[model samples]
Target: MTDTSKKEQLYELIRANPFVSQQDLAVELRLSRSAVAGHIASLIRERRLLGRAYVLPDKRPVLCIGAANLDRKLRTLETLQMGTSNPAYAEEVHGGVARNIAENLARLGLPAALLTAVGDDPAGSALQSRAESAGIDTRGSLRLNDTYSGTYTAVLDERGEMVLALADMALYDKMTPEFLASRAPQRSSAAMVVADLNLPQDTVATLLQDARRDAVALVIVAVSQPKMARLPQDLHGLRLLVLNRGELETRVGRKLAGDAELAAGCREVQAQGAQDIIITCGGEGVYHTSYTLAGEAGLTWLPAPKVDVVDVTGAGDAFAAGVCWSIYQGNNDLTLACRRGLKVAAMTLESPDTVSPLLAADILEEISEFHPLHLPQD
Candidate 1:
């Protein structure tokens, strides 16, 4: 056969049998083993085959695109002293809205990927390494020279409630439309896309536009009340929007009073184009509603299981992860999803870690609720 014919045959063999060895390809293509190796290398260079054993990059992961930061939290031991320093304990961890959610999904045994800009610094290295170790695909993440990784330092009272938070995350502003476009292949292939408001307004718009074009589920998680302005006025392609009551009020440009007012505010956000809205009330519970082709699904409230709060940092992200996992598992019931979200949030609140290392796939099954464990007899 000609060189072109040999290469074509080699690819066909690999496609038919992904586990076919180089030696088998040599015999199948009537070429030397070395020649077969060359052909395989050529095919990989052209992006036909993904990796060893002819693995394909075909997994439809939950694509999370936004900030990844180094987190520092300090909790005071004594009563309040605003102007002067108080005795406290400090802890550091890898954190960011998207990053924390991605870690949670990965820990829940879902295929997850992250696309975010990180500085080529030690902290950034640790961030990527930790995500990869947690089974998050970070290949599409960016590393820029001379940019220090973003940092979020939170000060908490003795009760573990956040008092103030300071952040230096200018690096995410560099995430441009061009950068997002460069990762279009990932976006197009995702089962769903989750983004945080830490990104710039234009970048968020680009992501929303791309999600609309690709007909993919896009979920937006608000990072903070101040960053709510970074969200575009049009959220037409959004599948779900998870935010706190304060963030929702900021989005609706009004102060929400009670459940009725919150539902109205959610409708206002729905008018802005979010398909579903989940407004977390921390310990109180969550207010949520879903929209379909017909019309608005009725709003519902689910109280969180009462638990002693250990740390409140990861509760929101964990809740978002729980809802995302439920949706990924084909459960569109918003009430049940919020139940799972509340469960995850409660678990995270009891742990001091940001992404709760204790999360596992089995947590999705509420042993106390409907699901029961049944083991096979030996």
Candidate 2:
């Protein structure tokens, strides 16, 4: 078959079975596996297809657009209740939801960029230095003089679980539509674009809509506080929306606190316009459902393998990064992505840091001891 004919057949095959194997494509197109791979690469570049599944086939970078702030971590010998004020040991660390994602991506060997606004203040300088050290591209992020940098103050007990958090994200609120519009082309090249609700509603809305318009793979991290949970209800075109069980319940104004609740919540969110949904239930693992182009219409659930819970601070973000990267690679194989996500989340829990203890080079080794990607049903 001619190249055009092969491309057409491949599209039909994918549309019919979005999760079809590339080996299958090679056979059906009557082409060498390399040739099939090259064609798929071209199609991805043209935005004719999104990510495929497998081990990181494309090294395309991930983009994170959100807030970066300095974390003033307050440590106490015992838990400091949220409302009870007391003197505590405090230390400043680089933090923010978007910055955390970027650091994790860099550690995963996926080049990532952060497009956000930070103040030109000393705290902002510290954050910039830390992000640069992590090898994140910050060219697209802007610095403002008038607005002080965003900051978070967290009070933690000896166990390291947070007692309360106070966030000042007013700087990020200044990021405008025109700013993102100018950066849209760069954003469009992303293998995945991760966003958090720290941004103003208009800014977040613009990014999601632009991702849809440009056909970029999008990963929306619903970083829920009682405040962030009021996310705009009209997120129509996101490829994936990642949230914790409580956040999902709050967003939909319904109870979805278990695996079954998560599954139902995924469907509910999908109906609201997101193409795929995942609700992470702390110890129970992740509940994922996406519109599989192949199987029956609607969503399908994949359970992430369970592990002992430690720190839960960054687990959801780590899971989002893993699933987004896997899905971008054309692997709609939810079980595989979930396993990767769980592995990353576990690594984060085992460490003191918000990212993972394992670096990019250690991912394969870390996951190798776990159940293989294609787990067999007994």
Off by over 4 Å in 1: 1-58, 290-298, 367-378
- For model 1, residues 54-109, the per-residue Cα lDDT tens digits are 64455568989998999999999988699998999999999999999999999998
Q: Worst lDDT window (10 residues) for model 2? A: 369-378
Off by over 4 Å in 2: 1-59, 79-89, 225-230, 257-261, 290-311, 362-378
Give candidate 1's root-mean-square deviation (CA, Å).
7.8
lDDT score, candidate 1, position 359: 89
**TM-score of each candidate structure, all chains considered together:** 0.82, 0.74
